[model samples]
Target chain A: MEHYNMNLTLKVWKQKNTNASGSFEIYQVKDISSEMSFLEMFDVLNEQLILEGKEPIAFDHDCREGICGMCSMYINGRAHGPWEKNTTCQLHMRAFKDGDTIVVEPWRSKAFPVIKDLMVNRSAFDRIIQAGGYISVNTGNAQDANALPIDKKNADDAFMAAACIGCGACVAACKNSSAMLFVSAKVSQLALLPQGQPERESRVLNMVAQMDKEAFGNCTNTYACEAECPKGISVSNIARLNREYLSASLSTEE
Target chain B: MGLTGLFLVTFLIVHAGVNACIFINDGGATFNAAAHFMSHNWVIRIMEIGLFAGLIAHILQGLLLWKQNTAARPTKYAMSAANENSKWYSRSMGILGSLLLIFLVIHISKFFVGTKVAMYADGGANDASHNLYLEMKEEFQKWWVVLIYSLGVISLFWHLLHGFQSAFQTLGINHKRYTPLIKTIGVGYTFIICLLFLLMPIAFYFGWIQ
Candidate 1:
């Protein structure tokens, strides 16, 4: 792959904390390598800000690979920038042209309050997981991997559902800031397998109740979550979640 | 919400089909008969109450959800590229539904009031004098009324385009194999239903149908 160096302007959001007012701060990074990941480019700009005796922009990142879902920059209006089905850390500087102005912000949702510039608190997701986090297992001995004999389709679909990284991009991408995609993915991964059968009903019902309690919007089925999701999680899981919720609500004694 | 939305969707089909009897070119004879039967039938009358229930439930549910959805994002994004991922119609359902609501008020006032009133006045007389087809012709002749009807149908078109497939997804009936078919059917249904409804007004206003 051909690599080139380019200079660009960055319009990054700057906020002190969740309660403080926020605004955009512009910076210029010179001679950025096209090979550099988007977060690396941010690191260079932060270095410049530090040398200039200004506060370095605060943001979040963990594994620079796409798995951690920590890099939650809403670049130039898109969830993880212009690349389809990509996380911000996997986004490279080559996606931009020299002298382009890049706008970066954090995931904006009432549940995902801005902890700092380009870093929103995502513990809302953890609470949602905790609400529906139980599965009953026969705990006598370690069973063989192939003992379950799961249908191939169910296995594949459950694996796909398990790929969600809890990035909150789906929430960022949704107009209503709905967490349905993330919640649905978690519900589906368990619901599709026979082992997950015991708590399938309660899992969906409690998770949905918790999600609503968190003040997240309901899904309108715009399918924007599927489009902006970095791991290519499907919207079909949402249908399954809805089905599970309906049955659970009707059947549950509680 | 999905259940009520689908109920309204089904109502559109029967309304459009019964009105399309005007296409028979029989000088309102066939059209009036169908209209009379629809107005006079007891089963349809009971279902009409259910239809009102569905419509009211749909509106109340939609308003509640819209309020919650709005509250969910108390702070507006400084910048968001929503169009990059979803269709504009899918996001603007509230506005479109509101527009349709206004149009529905006008429609019920113009046509439904007259039909039901006449039915009540006659009291099982089977009065063919009502001439609902003639009423359509007269009502649509007003350019402003026809314009309102046109706008209403346009809103219905966009609403159905998203709501049709959306209802299936919400009902948890979506499948990789059937979802595509559902979308295609949704498009076809939207076009045919909206076109028929739109053309009815234009045909009367322009003297294409008597």
Candidate 2:
């Protein structure tokens, strides 16, 4: 593919810490190659910032391979940039045009407090996951994956649910700010697998309760989370979460 | 609203069937007897408790969910353009549901509660069935009541359009093969029920039905 050189204007949020009042600061970058990944472009910007004796914009990134999901950003009004099924780091500069103005901001949610500019505290997600996302398998008691003999249908569903990276993009995209998609993904992943059967009841109940405690919003069926998700996770997962919650709540045993 | 709302879906189907019986033969006596039996029946009375419980649970859950959603995003959309990609019902479910709740209050007050207590309190001076039927007719005759009910029905339909499929999906009925089919069925059910419910008031208002 032929690469084109582009100049872009970026309005980025800057904050010292969680309590700090932040504002958008504009920056202009010159002659960037279209083939550069979004994070690479950020690298160029940080180089420029460091050259000017300024602190680099602190954003989250790790594998940059799209699987880790540590790279989270709201770009030009879309999560993970304009590309479908791609994370922010995987999004390349080619997605934009020559003289484009890009707006970059962090995932905005009360549950996800901002740690710094473009880096919000996503520990809320960790808490939700910890509250129930795993089965209680001991190290030696581990069974072979094939031992369960899950139906192909259920296996596929479990894979799909496991696809969720706990990115909190669902909360960012939802109008109600609901994390149903995230919670549901966790619930469905386990509910579909026999391994998850043991903690199934407590898992959904605790996660939902923790989700509420974190002050996440209830789902109002806005499918934005599914649409914006880099993984293309389904809203159906949220539906599953609700079902699990209901079942757990109505069950005779605690 | 998860379980209770789903339960109400069941109640809606049964309730609609019962109400539709009024138009089955267009016999005032038959309709009246049916209504009297429904109001006085012990089984239905127990179901009424379940219905109230469902309504309360649905509303409380909805409210809690709404509060959390609001808290999740302290900032409102800086611009309205982001809403272009969203479904109208999905965005407005809370508002629409609250409006429907208001309609439900009026509906129960007028028909269920009114027919049960007020209609009988008058010592049958007005025939119970005739009074109940006329009460509905008079309400439908007003253009505003018709308008309100029509809006309520549309909102109800939209709510169910998302809700029915969602409930099934949550219950783990979503096989890729069956999920789409189920969603289609959900849409169809919502459309038919809303259309049928709206027709009653509109037909009565226009004097198509006595």
Model 2 misplacement above 4 A = A48-55, A128-159, A183-212, A219-223, A234-254, B21-33, B40-42, B76-86, B127-129
Interface RMSD for all numbered candidates: 0.8, 2.6
Give the per-residue lDDT of model 2 (tens digit) for A1-254.
78899999988888899998888888988889999989999999999999999899989999988888888788887778777778998999999999998888888888888899999888888998899988787668667767768899788888988998877777877777778888888889999987899888999999999998998876666678888887888777776776678778999386
B142-199: candidate 1 lDDT, tens digit per residue: 9999999999999999999999999999999888799999999999999999999999
DockQ score of the complex predicted as candidate 1:
0.83
Span of 10 residues, lowest total lDDT, candidate 1 chain B: B119-128
**Candidate 2 docking: what grade?**
acceptable
Q: lDDT tens digits, residues A1-254, model 1?
A: 78999999888999998999999888889999999999999999889888899999998999988999999999999999999989999999889988999999889899999998989999999999999855766688878999989999999999999999999999998988999999999999998888789888889988998999899998999999999999999998889888889889999997
Which TM-score value belongs to model 2?
A: 0.83
DockQ of 2: 0.39
Q: Against the correct fold, how does model 1 do in TM-score? A: 0.96
DockQ of each: 0.83, 0.39
